[model samples]
Target: MNRLFNLVNQQDNRQLLMNTIRNGRVANAYLFHGPEGSGQEGFALEYAAMLNCQSRENQPCGQCPSCHKMKTLEHGNIHLVFPIRTGSLEKNDPPFKNFGPDDMEEIQNCIRKKAENPYEKLCPFDGKHIPINFIREIRRKIYLTAPEPGYKVVIVFDADLMMEPAANAFLKILEEPPDKTLLILTTSNIDAILPTIRSRCQRLHFPALSTTDLGNHLRENGIREDRINLVMRLSGGDVRQAIQLKEADLGRLREMTLEALRMIAIWKIDKVYDLVNRFVTLRKENPDEFDRLMLSISFWFRDAAILKAGKPESDLVHADMQIEIRKFVDYYTELDAFGAYSAVDNCIDLISRNVYINLALVNMFFKIHNRIQPGKSQ
Candidate 1:
């Protein structure tokens, strides 16, 4: 068993994939669909290792030469494609496409980090998407055929991030790949993938981790029990997010979430402007943290909802904020907590679609304001 699969607590997926390999039912192309932080990508790498392992029995002998290469992600047969941003995108470029020499170095470094930690994010640049050239490079290698005898395993992480042209170009390869090739497309949003492409691949779903597993992992990380309880709720069984939240000093994000609620509750022009600007900076400086900030607020409102529904404070995820939640609930006698949560969720959706941050946030502020304090001006 791969060590990373254990890290992600993907026992079921591990069994399923091992069975596929043993039964010789591996598909030419597979779609790994699951929520973010699930073990889709990790399992994809593990599957590649199993297929290319040198030993016939007791597959993926980590001691084998091919297995060692897969461990470092330097195997000649492995093709990894993810969202990438380069300084240039020259039409006639190959391998790296428009990427300059410096970009290639950075990419290698990123790969080294990925080899170290499977969950390390690949792209440093923002708003990157899978490019057509990357797809072409893989197709080129498949046709050229490397000298080595191994499965040509192509794993495209976040496949839904590919734009239409790239997706369309990819469909050609997906529709018809060489005999010894396997392509796995991993995505958190399957609906974003084109229907044509989806229809052609064998789909495998990765379910979120269980709360018990999440808590046990957090405990192993030496996180405090108090924080573990909160993370178990906020991370929603997302293994990567649980790890990130532990290292990210998620307390700061929670504090910011509380402060942002106070700002919105004020419903003043200057305060709202300052809040939005702060968020813009957070989004640019630390996108993951910013995302958690929004997620944190939704749960805060959920806690408020619990209080409004006459539930005890023990029912609140934000039990520490019981006093504040009680006061907020008391003040807004007609507050619709779910509606407020939806307003924030809508803002997350808008930002995800590359909507202007200022507009998305401002619209969210006003929407919540109107929902709770009807006709309230900001």
Candidate 2:
């Protein structure tokens, strides 16, 4: 049996799934919902491989032909689906029409990437929805007889991105899946999924990894020792984000965050303005870095809030900046500290929705400044 999945921290979930498979009572449909990077998709792939493995062992034997194919996502019985830009069709950029040769190639590439690294996040190239056309094709394919003598597994990553039409088209299959078929849907936001779909599937919840687990995983992955601490704190236990941070220019972002906080606390309007301008420029140059900067600011406020609440120092994401956080905490009431945290969160939400970078940063700066002012009440 493959031991790859044992590395994941969700022991209860793993045990339950293994029990069901051993008992030969696998559910027709399952919803794996949790925060992003909490091992939903990884578990889905592992479970799929286990179901189709030919050895009939308690877990997937990595040596079997079925297991080999499943590992590389070449198994005929496994279908992987994810959201794609419906509009890409009009541009002839990996169009969705009839799932043409180009579309098939793109889908295969995506699956291969996932097979290589189950923790890798798959996102639409441009659009937001999993179009009805894709779901329709999946529904048709699911009704067909399995090509081999094992379970057919259809795994949908980010299933919450299904549009209304596509989601409606999927209900029938979810309600009456074919014999020897398993449909697994994964999503970071459960509320975004249809109630009917949620009701039809057995829900499994995944929790964020603990700090110790995350730290160990990073070290084992050969991540630099010096950067591990910062990434660990910034990841909030999300492995994907931690991986991204490995390649990210986090030092610059940390400097910006600290400077912004220092300027805000001192009420240095000119320095804040200059900082916001630099942020706008960074957003134009590399939007991802800009987002990371905003996340850093959020963490800064979070650390201040933790200090204000008289929480243990160990709880701080920026524990290395304990002195600064302590000083910052003295400048605001607990309510204002929390208010600053909320303001940063609001800014992140707006930025995610494609709000103008300069306006969002400027407004966020002012909001944070107000909350952190020495005499502010709320």
What candidate 2 gets wrong by more than 4 Å, as runs, is 4-7, 88-95, 98-106, 224-229, 258-272, 283-288, 298-316, 319-378
User: TM-score of the candidate numbered 2?
Assistant: 0.77
Highest lDDT model number: 1
Please give the lDDT score at residue 76 for candidate 2.
90
Question: What is the clash tally of candidate 1?
Answer: 0
* Residue-pair clashes per candidate: 0, 0
Candidate 1 wrongly placed segments (more than 4 Å): 1-7, 86-92, 95-97, 257-291, 294-298, 301-315, 319-378
Whole-structure CA lDDT of model 1: 0.80
Give the alpha carbon lDDT tens digit for every residue of 227-344 in model 2. 5666876666788778777544666666777877777766667787888788778878987777677777777778777777778877676655678778667645443877888888
